[model samples]
Target: MALRTYDEYIESLKAMRPNIYKFDELIEDVTTHPATRNTVVGHGHSFKLSSEPEYKDIFTTTSHLTDEPISRYLSVIQNREDMWANSRLKRRMFQLSGTCTGGRCVGWTSLNSMYATTYDIDQELGTDYHQRLRAWLKDAQRRDITIAGALTDPKGDRTKTPSQQDDPDMNLRIIERRKDGIVVRGAKVMICGVAAANEIFILPGSAYREADKDYALSFVIPRDIENLTIVETRHPSDKREHEEGFDIPVSEGGITQAYLFFEDVFIPNERVFMAGEYKFTKQAVFNFISAYRAAIGGCVAGQGDIKIGAAMLVARANGLHTKVFKDKIIQMQINNETTFGIGIAAAALGKEHPSGTWLCDMTLANVNKVHVATLPYETSRLAQDIAGGIGETGCMPSWKDFQSSRYGHLIEKYLKASSSAESRTRAARLVEWLTIGAGVPGCMHGGGSPDGAKLMIRAFGDLESKVEIARRLAGISEEIPEPGGR
Candidate 1:
């Protein structure tokens, strides 16, 4: 079947009844809830783009599994074109939401990584995980299902492995192995986009030793799984949503981050793609996250574009468009475009995995994430700076107040710069949304934390080769002895 249209996708979400909680109460309907409905609209934008004639090529693709058209989020990268297409689709998704598009990018990256990593594991251990996963992907593509990626562990202690955790529940584990499937217990913290997803894929977050066998569990759980409960994350701005309701200053498009609780949730045997395969866990996590980090460079750069534009608009309205202010605008643009360039460069340098999927260059991918970790934060800082003190002082004025004679003249007299009072207010609102609302944290840690990016740099640094080059250049290289012919 071809991919579902935007309307059809929304209908599917409306049909599912998820057991989700936010703020101390159960969310009755995801489509109407203030905190989650906006995110659903953000996801709808992705489906809308896929159907639009201008975006069809980038957002939709012919599935390798079914040969039918599917969302690019469901397409596996098998060639250079596919790699570029994946990067483009993710950027569009991020721009639509102005935040994370949930778990689409992570799941997309994991598809290729799991295929390649499992192939190597199967070759060494006679396992058939690669085949099982391919079968599942075919089903997912045909059905157009949204799969949430569960990669981060609760990580109860900084210095301990999963096996050494004080509480086993701190690590997701296989509590029972039945003839039908494996039953898992434990929870995943900071899982992205749980409110909007139809299913979840749990993958190991760290390398597993033989002693951590039960910790090496991987499978898919339907959002409606009997024992699963989702507690949506509370952001600092969430209170504003509660106070102001739907018109929460920020855009109607945002993402929902949540913690997932799996209380003895069961996965059918067909869905249990990885079980007690400790050796493959590390490769699975690394391969997936590295590719995802490269994709983040594109998504974060797109969000930066929106933030930078908002700041510039506020600057112009405040009559702060002097050379110094314009120069700051130029700096914002440079920060954004630099991050975007790394994404394209990594895609250009991609190599084929053993399974034939294109793998982005690891070094360039890590470099892209490092920039993502720092540049957006710096850009947001400059944006808040240029926005002046009004961002902090501006009071919420109703449309009635703007139109009334009591305060209309006063607002027009004080708020106007290059435009009317309404325009300046809108600009200020946009700036507030990016600089202090839902956008900044995603910029800082969406791909990974800045420190996580630095860790990758140290882990992947090839300093030994640099040392050898330095020795040779300094005329201190030792000659290697050659074996004499017999």
Candidate 2:
């Protein structure tokens, strides 16, 4: 089977039912709709890249299931090598797209995480979920579809669990289990990249108690499946998506989030990987973050790469040499590599799961997650610091205004720096867009919150042994405790 080209991909999305909406208006064609088109176009770049000889390896891989040349987006991370490839692919995607290409990144991780989880489920519960997943994956590879992974649930109150909530639908739940399939109801909010996807991969939002079994659900369904309504979430860049200006550096690239309401959606048994398996919910979530958090280092680093380039361009636009901000640029480079190196370390140090999937080192991956949450902002700050006020602030005239008859010439003439008016303004706009616009990704909480990663750090780390090692090195054999504890 052949992989999808960029045009074929767009046509496929166009053929889907109109279930996605933005600004209370139905998006008939995602490829042309202002709200969704940019993201779709951004993701489509990978389709073109997959055909190129140099990038073919980065974007295309043989599916282990069928041994067919498929999109790397469809490849499973079977070993440390595959995991490293996945990380590099993510960084390259961000480098080219200049934004989050969640259509494949998260969904790829979701499938891989489920690969391990379903194996455990089948071993203990004697279910055929692993087989079901294999069948679905085989078909998915054949189609070369774009999948957006959905994991976050809008829990109404923090203190209450899913079962304790007055609204049981606070977390997505299985409303009923028919012989042929299951019925699901509830919303997955703030899900990234649904606007650019052909399908949605659903995973349990979090660990759940047996009493909350209804909420312990996972499945895959067409994005436009009946009873599914997608509403693109709001962002500071919403207006900029439609703006006629240098505000959006790349008109074909942007990022999106959505609220997916599954109003009693029916997913066939073959597509259901986990249903009412509350005991394995924690395992499923663990499997997910292990990969998601680690690779996110690449995501931020890619954007940081762009930030550095834009900042330098702005400096030259102002007639300043690169040496003027050498220290700042060096600091930005350090920030990018820190998170990136930590992620690669996690991948290299990982152990293979029983399911033949490579799981990242929990301690190092969480450590990267913490860096992902904090370092990108400092990088952004340095880029802005180097770009000057015009590049950092969205205060310049719009592209339309810059072309207006009345004051266009005056505006253009004053906007000129050491570079031409157009070049100077364009560089400024790019820096602004990257640092503060849609180019900014969910660094602090893309996969999960940093606090959650810290908790995992505590769980996976050997702190007691570290303390013992410290005691021996200090030549203090007796137990020396903290102020209040032994």
Candidate 3:
């Protein structure tokens, strides 16, 4: 059934048939499981927001192929306005979901990359990859499916390539080819929403060499495919939540990343977007980054809004909302706005690619990601600072204490916020949930590491032109015959 509401999406996950493993055992119900439920809730919020009238323009779009209304996540940006709209939509979705929306951006990025790179591949290799991709995307929209993108391969050793890994299955690769389809093996790690996703859109993590051609595989498969298994990573707080219920300091956060195993799984040719297209991998990566990096600015900033608000509320509860705390709040606002500002700048400065869709300004897009890698860390640091010692020491008192007639009055008396323990506890829980709970570290690393942002800055920054500018300023222009050289 096409998902029109958050309820529909949740119901869809409840009905999914998949070989999903959490720890060592099979998970019968991912939709209701503690480990997967929060992530699914986050995903549901994303879908729910799109239907809100105020956000409809940003979150929903007319598909270029079918002209039917589809989630912005499924649509390719056909114009500059579409680019800006998507950035804004992503921010709202992330804000509604708190921090991580369980890799929805990854899926969106995959779609953008496939659209751009497929067109280029068809142009260069006379392949129909672009046509096939569009057809698949159209179907995905018609079905209103949720896709989890599998991009990060488990690099068994940082020193080696996929084919050179000690265990070839450490990195996902194509195993065999049949006339109708291909079989694949190996695994994709740190895959978000694998259990909740209807389909897994698989792609190589990096460019490949001729010897590594078999490792250069890309395709789409149902999450419930027979031979595919998802072993979900356990969140640091998962055990506590199951044992203690909402009494755990932080009850809601991004759940876990799952490692998806493809054990000789067959993917029909129609589902294969790119296979052994080594050169196109780089193009695909860049195309995805061009749009996705810009998107990070929006979502992270939105998350910052939540963090900042929580921090201020906590500080107020703890009687620490001083002028200094106010200033920190201002700083948080600046960081949040600046991050979002870059996303808008990237989108506003977008250019249409030769493939007929718009491409965000690469320089601004990289700048957006660079800010995303840093600003949220600063925001979290300040949040922790305001939270203070009570944030660490506070806990939910037993419900029995409140339920007892004799202790009930005393519990209420002691639990009040100003004089109210409940208020203080709630504040602390909010701080704990966001800072160390599940949001901060993931925000820093989810899109990419800090070093990745620096690398992008170096690549996009034109040092050669700066050097030429310096030479001209020093009266050393070649037109003037510098140092008597012709």
Candidate 4:
């Protein structure tokens, strides 16, 4: 079968009838629920883009396995060009949506990470996990399924490893190992788009020691599988979606995240990609981080574009588009381009792993993420500065209020700026959503925190080369210690 259309994608989700709960109430239909419907719409847009002629090259790619056109989200990154293409595709999707991509691209990164790791494990241990994953990838491509990448575990204690924790269920673990399959029991927090996704791809969030074998597991399962529950997380201004108005500008096509609970969920052997291979968990995580961070840099830069554009629009509407505001806009552009350029560099510098999957340059990828962690906030600050008090004000007159006979003329007269009252209001709302609402926190910690990126940067940097350069420049002798001498 060919790639599914937008309507087909929606129907496919409706057919799943995932076990989702929001605000302590069971959502009967996620396709129509206010909290999750927008996420489905956001993901549906990607499917639409794949079928358009203009976006065909960016959003669709030929599958190496089936030799058929498949969503780029399911394509393997075979070379540096593919890596660069992944970043460009993510940026284009973000720019079009003006918000998150609803976690549609996560499965692609997970596939690439798992593909490389499984192959390496097989080469070392003579396991057949690589072939198993390849078969699944082919089917996923043919079906064009949306997959949610679940990585973060709800750690009960920050200082303790999974096995060290007093509560064994704090981190996702294999509670029972049967001959036919394994039963996993735990919870994953902040799982983006899980309620709308067709499948969930699980990966270890941290490296595990030998003793933490049960926690060092990875697998995939249907989102609607039994013994699983999804609890949606509330974001700032989320309730605005249920309200009647043009007041909630960003909610038009928003995103959703949730907590995923696995209550002894059964995973057949075919779905189990990694189990008890503790040493490979670290490599799997690093691969995912490199791909995820590079993609995020591009996505965040695209969002920065929207923020800068909105800031300029707001400044113009308020008659504040002067030299000061123009300079601030330029600063925002600089930060955005810096992040976008690093993502491109990381992709261009990618190297092919022995498993034939491409991996981005780790140092540059981490650098890209670190910049994204702070630059978006800086962009938002400049935007709010130009927007004045309007950006900070949360409450605005509803659409009904503007249309009322008693307040229509009053609002029209007072709310008017350099532009129409409606346009000005929309610009302010957009800036508010991009800056203070949902956007900032997502940028700060979406892939990983800035501190985590710094650690990876330190781990991957060429410190020895820098020391040698300094020694040669300063005419200092290089001291070498004898192997046996302390």
Candidate 5:
């Protein structure tokens, strides 16, 4: 696939078969449908930026398979610089689009995760999964299509494993293994950006035992594949999605999560990277999270940067100098850099796999994930605190109400602050959206939960070594017992 221009990107999406739905309505055209259009526009900007002289370096990379330039979204991360660039690109995307571009980022990380995983599987089992992945990625780079990733399943019981669940379809599983392909059934819930994606990369939701082999599946397929149905999930900004004007900040860009129901959807063998490979599921998921969580630091930092700007803008609109909130703004900056710095540290401490793919340090990456889960919300709170009531409360009149012919003049006159009523309204709306509306990304639980990340942190922690060092410093050889006296 050749590199697509912004127009080409729109056209490409326009060509896909309509399979997305929102509230029981069939979306015939994702390019213009309000429910899907913003996401498409947000992802489309990546294509536009890839060709720009200023952003080309971070947006495009040489495809290892084809020796041709491809969207960084379509390239594999092979080194520290590549990983750093990935983080930078994610940050820039949020800086510009002001939301999650899951149509690209998660899918990009999925393919990269599989790049290392498939290699390891093939080496140990003499499987052809790696070769197939390389071939698929080469074709993908050629097509340069947007691919979304799906990992969350409509798991019925949090405590039960897939095989133990009352309903087997609780987790996506291989229903039938045909000579040509495999048939899958079940659903991936709360997936991001299916409407804007041409194809989707699916991975096992979690590690599985042999009994759950059917659930240990990985593959890619067309988003509009036969027997597949997509339902756009509801969010806090549902009513304003179609609203025109500054009521919805970054109107051309948006966030969407979807639920995908697959009814015996067939994925061809070449597109199947893992099938019934229960043994490799842990590493596969582990690999994906390290990259995803690390890069999410940049995602939140970029949006955090916007939070800083919006707070300042609101202060300006109220005729107050930004320096008045210097301490709060500085705290926001600290939160942003802490998350970003931890991600960079993870990338820097990584080691390359035998497959030639680089993996972020698990401990540092998970720690950053914890930071992403908590710090951004604090930054947002600070932004809202500095914004005063109008920006934080969402009490402003509708953009339409303000523009009405009968009372437009009166509304404008009273709404005016130190600045023009229009400017103040727009700035307040921007702040409201960033802190509470669609502009918010999956900061707290996007890739995974903070609790989950902490579990990983505990897994990777070396507490015994630290205890030994402490003992040496204190010159105490005697064992110290805990409250439980283990």
Candidate 6:
């Protein structure tokens, strides 16, 4: 079967025994553990969506290679419409989950990037990397497997190149190339959804020169492979999961980050898509980021929808849903719509690559990312302003306290405002979750930090044209170009 049911996906995850750690303790069953179970459930929603009639068109697509129906998460973008559908699917998934859906989108992004870059590499150097990747992707589609994309390396010294570093292993590299395969040793930090994935796709996070050839590699490996360890990173309010009667609204659908270590892990020759192709490193990374950042614009705007809804709820509960607060809500809508508009523009303006995969417009994608880095914060600030004192009051009384026979009446009396105490308390919890807990920081640096988007904007934007326009307007030059021309 090309597509798997939700139950089948969960069962597949249960069959593989991965090495995972949380707080120095081994997680015997990631699918059942509190720290990871929600993420798996969130991921499973994608499978469910694909099977449903309403979402089938967006979530399932025909595989170009095999001519079978496969999840869109595993299919390559074949045209501009596919790109637009991809962004809309991401936004819908985020709105449904109320958090990032682990790493499914990351896998989709990396697959398209590899398809485009490897085709170029093979055409130029007469290599078979594209064919190898195509074979692997077809198998992955048939199995409907979840693949986590690992991009960031644990660079020990930011100022030093991989070769210049005192410890060469700090950046993942080929320590030994055997006849059948290669041995890789190093670590990747800020990895998303490794514990729940069936496999991981590794790519160089930054561009590299010839001297960094060893570090400029890309490949795929199974999560349960030997010599690989995954440690889940701790986040703020993570302990709330263990506390009874502490209903965290935002975290109901959990997300994850981890540190992945590969110590002399052997990757078979067939799985090695790119090995020592340093010159193509930049293209691979840029291709991935351009698409991923556009996705961020859509998903983050979905999150902005959540923030705006919470703000409106709080204002109504506080008996302050007047023109002033209504205007704030409108402003939040403006920011949210702006980001979503950019994402659609990026997708609509995408161009096809030689490899038959569509690539997003770089300038618009960077602009989308830059807006994502800043607009969400302002949305959160407006949410807090509308939330008023309740936003700063911290978490509400525990469910236990609200249920206690002795204190229940007192809480019900004091907490009640323009509405029931339960409504106000839950609204406050949601605001806290979106503003200070996980939502704000995630928006500010999810795809990449704001400064990173700024650098990309500078690189992709055409400043020379703007200068020419200014000079021509001032009659400094006789020539004036046509509209939309340089």
Per-prediction CA RMSD (Å):
4.2, 1.5, 3.5, 2.2, 1.6, 3.4
lDDT tens readout by residue for model 2, 400-448: 8788899999988898889988888887787787788776768988898
Task: Give the poorly placed runs of model 4, Cα more than 4 Å off.
Answer: 241-244, 247-249, 322-324, 478-486
Q: For candidate 6, write residues 296-377 as lDDT tens digits.
A: 8778777788888888787788877556687788888999888888887887888889999988888888888889888888
CA lDDT, every model vs. true structure:
0.76, 0.88, 0.75, 0.83, 0.89, 0.82
Best by lDDT: 5
Task: Estimate, for each residue in 1-486, the C-alpha lDDT of model 4 and write its tens digit.
Answer: 659988888888889855999889998888898878777777777888887899899888999898999998888898877877787887786776666764677777888899999998899888888998999989888889999897749988989999999999999999999998899999998877776689988888888899999988888888899999989999776655443555344554566778988999999999999989999999999999888888787788888888888888887888764566778888998998988889888988889998889899999999999999889889989988888777764656766777889888899788889998888878887888778775665687788789999999988997767878888889989664447873
Which residue pairs show collisions in model 1?
none
Poorest lDDT segment (10 consecutive residues) of candidate 1: 241-250
Q: Is candidate 3 or candidate 5 better by lDDT?
A: 5
Cα-based TM-score, every candidate: 0.92, 0.97, 0.91, 0.96, 0.97, 0.94
Pairs that collide, model 3: 415-420, 415-421, 415-422, 416-420, 416-421, 417-420
Tell me the tens digit of each residue's lDDT in model 1 across 1-486.
568776777777777766889987889878788768877777777677777899999988887777889888877787767876766777777676777776565666666777777788788999878888888889888878776788757879968988888898789999999988898888888877767777787788778999998998777767778998889888656655343322453545777788888889889887776889998888887777667877787777778788777777777887766466877778888988887778778778888877877777767778888888888888888877887765542454655566678877886687777877777777776666766776766666665576777777777777567767887888986843335721
Displacement of residue 150 (Cα, Å) in model 3 is 1.5
Better of 2 and 6 by lDDT: 2
**Global CA lDDT of candidate 4, please?**
0.83
Model 6's TM-score against the true structure:
0.94
Q: Can you tell me which runs of candidate 5 are displaced by over 4 Å? A: 247-249, 478-486
Backbone clash count, each prediction separately = 0, 0, 6, 0, 2, 0
lDDT score for residue 48 of model 1: 75
Residue ranges of candidate 6 with Cα displaced over 4 Å = 241-252, 322-324, 393-395, 477-486
5 or 6, greater by TM-score? 5
Instruction: Give per-residue lDDT, candidate 4, residue 254.
Output: 68
